[model samples]
Target: MADGTVKRQIAAKVRQAFAPLRLEVVDDSERHRGHSGYREGGESHFRLTVVSDVFSGKRRVERHRLVNSVLAEELAGPVHALNITALAPEEDSA
Candidate 1:
């Protein structure tokens, strides 16, 4: 799928999986331009920040693993890199 489509799917999956109180998915592929795994259409890189109750008791690795598992299809396809910031709702003072 294309960049926009991938972005939409990522957002949809995360929203569905976590029911996050706050979530942001950023496509950072454009900045990678001609870098390896960077496609011309720019959907290969992403940064996701999520705040949810589900992350409350989880370690950082577990949080990342959960997100990675949920987005496995995307990673197996057009997505090349992902940076995730996972936080519990109680941890979010802002």
Candidate 2:
């Protein structure tokens, strides 16, 4: 996968896996320009904020693990850093 499409691919995979009510996948690659793991064309670093019922009753780490499991391939490949904020729908109201 090319750098430009990784975020879209991630959003699709997360939607498939968790069915999040709200999902935002932001590519922060530009912020790390010229740093290690920073690809010249961007899409190296990303931050995901996901709200879903699938996260209900799960611990924070577990939620992260859930996302990590889904994105294992991306993490192991072109993705450099993934900063995730996974939240249950209920928690979002808090």
Candidate 3:
């Protein structure tokens, strides 16, 4: 996969799986420049902020797990690290 492709895949998969009211998938690979798992073209790391009804009653770990499962292929492939902030629609003021 190309650099931008993984980012698109993450966003699309999350949208399909949760239909989140709000979703932001940021590519954080640049910040990990000389660190481990840093790839040449980026898309190796990400930060996800998602607000959806699907997370209404779920715990932090549960929410992460749901997202992890949805992006299992990416996680096992190009994506090295994922920083997730999942919240219910009501929990997000922004």
lDDT tens digits by residue: candidate 3, 1-94:
4448888989999999999999999999989999999998899999999999999999999999999999999999999999999999889999
Error of 3 at 62 (Å): 0.6
**RMSD, every candidate, angstroms:** 1.3, 1.8, 1.1
* lDDT, residue 33, candidate 2: 87
- lDDT for each residue of candidate 2 in 14-79, tens digit (9 for 90 to 100): 999999999999899889988899988778899999999999999999999999999999999989
Model-by-model lDDT, in order? 0.93, 0.91, 0.93
> How high is each candidate's TM-score?
0.93, 0.92, 0.95
Worst 10 residues of 3 by lDDT: 1-10
Ranking by TM-score: 3, 1, 2
> What's the distance in Å from true for residue 22, model 2?
0.2
Question: What would the C-alpha RMSD of candidate 2 be, to one decimal place?
Answer: 1.8
What are the runs in model 2 whose C-alpha is more than 4 Å off? 1-3
| Ten-residue region with minimum lDDT total, candidate 2 | 1-10
Candidate 3 matches the true fold with a TM-score of 0.95
